[model samples]
Target: MNRRDNAPGASADIGAALYGLATRAARRLPRDMSLTSAATLATLDRTGPRRITDLAAVEGITQPAMTTLVRVMEKSGLVERRGDASDKRVTLVCLTEAGASYVRTRRQAGVHAFERLISELTGDEVEALVAALPALKHLADLESQDREGQNQ
Candidate 1:
């Protein structure tokens, strides 16, 4: 039997469709930026400076792995490390201006790509997608809450 036959609600169908679209969209993105690097940059840009441990947690990576990733990003001029003023023992990682600009450029490129694809969709399909976005966001929030609960 088809999996959709076992699924309930338009939400499930929409979610699966969106997931497929996102997978294809990610494949279409420029090869210059890795998804992890883009995610790190976007997180830093949105949240400002963070300790390496915190960054690792946000990125869902091991501390040592995050350390290595940060070092690689540092070498590429995307991030900089500075001493935390209040906690002299702790170091804060932040995006350089170049990193922020790079993230913005990549985001714009992704948006443009999506917009082009969206433009091809019928008006009713676009309306359906727009209507689904709020529920999708809520689902994401629910999943995050579930993770947090599990962690605690």
Candidate 2:
């Protein structure tokens, strides 16, 4: 809405600021698992069961690495591999009840963290963030769409 918003480097500035905020916030949170494991769990929670290879592609990791991670998760009872109902030859990894619980707990923790941080902001700052939420959510939707397109 401001004149400077359309200036060169504005988008990058916004991106960097957002990334820095997220990185710092993430560092302050407890880490129960590696980011890859967390992301894999989130992916399953978001998009349902996925082939190991598809997960690997989505996470930008090697299939064998994904397999090892899946095996560990399975052993820990976080995830289970099941035969694809439509294709018996393929396997899909899905979240177990424990995994779903973990995802919900983790998401709640993130919400709490953000809420605490937001509580410290001035009234105007809080209003700005509240107003920006729809745009932020739209950004996330765009990214999700792009990722889904890639997977397809």
Best model per TM-score:
2
Candidate 1 Cα outliers beyond 4 Å, as residue runs:
1-11, 136-152
Residues 81-152 of candidate 2 have per-residue lDDT tens digits of 999989999999999999999989988998998898889999999999989999899989998999878876
| Candidate 1: residue 129 Cα off by (Å) | 2.6
Worst 10 residues of 2 by lDDT: 25-34
**Per-residue CA lDDT of candidate 1, range 34-139, in tens?**
7877788888997799988877777788889889989999999999999999989999999998999998998899989888989999999999889979987897
- TM-score on alpha carbons, each prediction: 0.80, 0.92
Q: Give the C-alpha miss distance for residue 8 in model 2, angstroms.
A: 3.4
Best by lDDT: 2
Q: Report lDDT (Cα) of residue 126, candidate 1.
A: 99
